[model samples]
Target: MPVRRADAPEPERRDLDVRGTSVRMLSGGAGPDLVFLHGAGGAGRWLEFQARLAERFHVRCPSHPGHGGSPAAEWIEHISDLAFHYLDLLDTLRLERVHLVGASFGGWIAAEVAVMASHRLASLTLIDPVGIKVDGWIYPFLFGMDIPEIVQTVFHNPMAALALAPPDQSVDTLAFQYRQGAAIARVSWNPYLYDPLLRRRLARITTPTLLCWGAHDRLAPVEPCAQAWVKEVPGARLRVFADSGHVPHVEEPAAVAAAIAEFCGGIR
Candidate 1:
């Protein structure tokens, strides 16, 4: 069901019907499953950093419903809907446990998954994530900004940011992206940045968790919003990328990949 993008270079892709929604996933290498979830407006292709980790772990990156080539689900309303869908994906794939890594909104989903199904996760990693609203800290609304403005705020290198913008997108594609962004904001906008109740639930997660933050992030600033995770999530470790912003994997792939490999490798 998952069709490979004609422009994509030889990446193995497949689709699984989870709760009646077709979920597109890209997979490579072999061994323990390591799933990567991208943030808003991102797709499975965003998991290029996981390619190196694939040599030791079968990396599974799924295009969240309504983003990339996946069809939007009418029943899905909240972020938890996406989280539960991922849990269903694991069940459909017969994956008993896996190492999960997510960015931004995907990170929020990963947190929800860990809280809901601890037995299914071997470990968890969140990068510049947004799921909890910290008092006194104001987080920016990324969806409200234009594409170029959003990129400028999230990436340190202007060239790298330029490379991420969809070059061949048609008017219809751009319109659809905006619509999807609006839908995501509608469900996730409450508390302005994150759900107020999410932080309270972090203490219950038993899996070894790592929180990676971009020191220069403007979208989800580090000092308070990002660092707070370490205090709330028991035994959670934090790694800050000095020269990076919101999307560290894109801004500094090697460092992001190395941190992930080191953390996941140490997990029992």
Candidate 2:
């Protein structure tokens, strides 16, 4: 529901065959290759954040398997499977020295991917990622909450979320949401969103990393989660948005996009 500017270029939708599994991708702009991995909710939607990035980078947003228009992959069992899948995706696309960005659950996947192959990425950006756990910090059970409550929990300001609200929750919309939730459950339900081994593996990531966080995040509180990531990932820097919550890109798209551009620009 983001207001599209007249000058914003329309993204091209294409289907990719990543190891025989068809993946849907929205790609546009004409600069360095930058791939964005969406959160549990934002898959397949080109938001204002991505549009802004498209102005500066050739943004490639692909829907994770089992989400969006992509069919579920039987081979995907754990979150690690997704990490390997994306590695294959990069090879399939013949992309090298890519700028990789991910948010929320997708952030977790990005971290796993970077751990396995940081050399493939030029820079890694994680926005409010939830791969590692800090003692005494607990993530809220998102599946237990209704859509409205989930919306409120994610956005610091109600009006910020309202500005991009969908017109209505039609049957198809609700079904799509349900399917996406189920896809999340498949990989994340066992340990309740955090991978026990991922924390130990983060040190393996040698890529230049940027950690973006919403200061007011209630889902994955910033004080511990953001700090934990910055501490574990070597040389990973933190950028906190004061007026946002869990989903800073959705709540403060322009600011988040600008920060990403600045960070990626400095990656050399």
Candidate 3:
């Protein structure tokens, strides 16, 4: 037996076909549209943070291709492809000037989207975003480690991660998780996660930006990397979540949700 999700909205999951790829998206609540792009581990299921956001804005969380229920778009071999695909996704969904929120890997995609097309965005919020490469900073062995090792490295509070996890772990669930990892490896392996040209292009993104980071992030060092985002991206503000890990939303759901709500409220 396996459980699905905890704190996720009771809404049924739906899929939309965009350019031959099934983009699995979950929509809930009302008000202005707010799109959530997940990180490398994949947006498993809507978390308490998403539910909280849905209270104030219409939240749309879509699983990246080859992750969750979203089928793989084999042609997508790079982060640039994902950026382009999201552009198409916006057109297909008929969404206009929506607020964008991305976490981890998704934050990189959000930055790419803003760089490629800022006209379609009203605001941008990144949580522990990873796109810029800093000299002398190296990420831990991602694909080389087991789940426990990665978990310990990813979250500051291991107890929170364990509590948030699905109580019933099934074979299918493990397989799905593995698939998401493989998909991440495919796109991120060559460049090793960060786009060589991204830092230079941050200046082109004109949308209001907010950078949120877990103080205990081990993957992307906080010093030069997160610091670099604030320095390079004009008008971008940084907020650090104390005692949180890479996924602050999971570790500190209420605080992260409140930060997002407040940020979105001031967007003009």
Top candidate, metric lDDT? 2
What C-alpha lDDT, on a 0 to 100 scale, does residue 219 get in candidate 2?
Answer: 88
1-268: candidate 3 lDDT, tens digit per residue: 1122465557447888887888888888788889999886556466677788888889888889988735678889889899998888898899978899999889999999999998899899999988778777877777888778888888898876764454457887777777777888887876787899998999998999989899999888678678989998889989999978888877887788889889878874
lDDT tens per residue, model 2, 1-268: 3455578878899999999988999998878999999887677778788889999999999999878636778778799999998999999999977999999988999999999999999999999988776778978888889768988888887666765454468987667666767888988886888889999899999999999999999988877788888889999999999988998988788888999999989976
TM-score of each: 0.91, 0.95, 0.92
Report, for every candidate in turn, its global Cα lDDT versus the true structure. 0.79, 0.86, 0.82
Give the local distance difference test score of model 2: 0.86
Best by TM-score: 2
Candidate 2 colliding pairs: none
Cα distance off (Å), candidate 2, residue 157: 2.0
Q: What is the lDDT of residue 150 in candidate 3?
A: 81
Can you give the lDDT of residue 83 in candidate 3?
91
Off by over 4 Å in 3: 1-9, 163-171
Q: Which regions of candidate 1 are displaced past 4 Å?
A: 1-9
The residue pairs in collision within model 3 are none
